[model samples]
Target: MATRIDLTLDCADARPLAAFWKTALGYVDEPPPAPFATREEWAAHFDPPEDDPDAADPAGGGAWLCDPDGVGPRLSILRVPEPKRAKNRLHMDIRVPGHGGPAERWERIGAESRRLVAAGGRVVTEFEGHHVVMADPEGNEFCVAAAPA
Candidate 1:
């Protein structure tokens, strides 16, 4: 069997970051485990200590997202006390779907970039006819590139 993996991001806040990623990646909030009606219900089962630094926020804690098509790894955004201090060693490359000439591919990349910008992402740099380096609302870097041909 193939090994499955989940991608995790540590952030000062998870809800807004997760919201931005959902729009950027076309992902949805992962449903609670079976038999649990909601995420809160599942969390209540743990009853973590109030002093536990890793505990989920009672106001609506960490956010989990999954690709709607079930093709991508699950995303787990956990809350952390410290802020991000440096660039990410690894980042996501969001490929725009298309098999076309440079001009057409650039157009597709530009469109996707614009959509992500509307979803709270900002362009860091653009390599015309190639890709655009972008940062999410929380300043995590990602790229918008043309799908491989």
Candidate 2:
């Protein structure tokens, strides 16, 4: 049977990435920390209970951020001690808005790819169907696909 989808981002800071993605994907923050009356109040509200299954970034790596408004999958930013080693065995293929198919699209990808590379990402390659391969700052691969109709 087919199941739902979840997106995981391996990054250094969960909040920043989550926030950036929230803006990028137009999603609200996962959830405010329970929204107490005051920041102090919320900060003060700590539970010393056991079996609540809370253990301080237990992923030891990343945190899960969600978008209830989005039809897309939930996103988790994991923090790993070691870094990504090689080319991704799996990659994300995203579609963006391009004027032309291959030539013009390749030009746009070239410009966008430059920006991504400048932002610490690399352009792994390009393909026929108006697609480009990109990686995030942490070297995890994703794509900037031509926007759909």
Candidate that would win on TM-score: 1
Q: What is the C-alpha lDDT profile of model 1 across 83-139, one tens digit per residue?
A: 889999999999998698999999999999999999999999999889999999889
**Cα lDDT for residue 104, model 1?**
95
RMSD of each: 1.9, 5.5
Candidate 2's TM-score reads: 0.58
The lDDT, on a scale of 0 to 1, for candidate 2 is: 0.60
Score each candidate by Cα lDDT.
0.89, 0.60
lDDT of 2 by residue, 9-117 (tens): 7666655555555544556545435565433344346652465333353334345566676677777676544566777777666545666666666676567666656
Off by over 4 Å in 1: 53-56
Task: Tell me each candidate's TM-score.
Answer: 0.91, 0.58
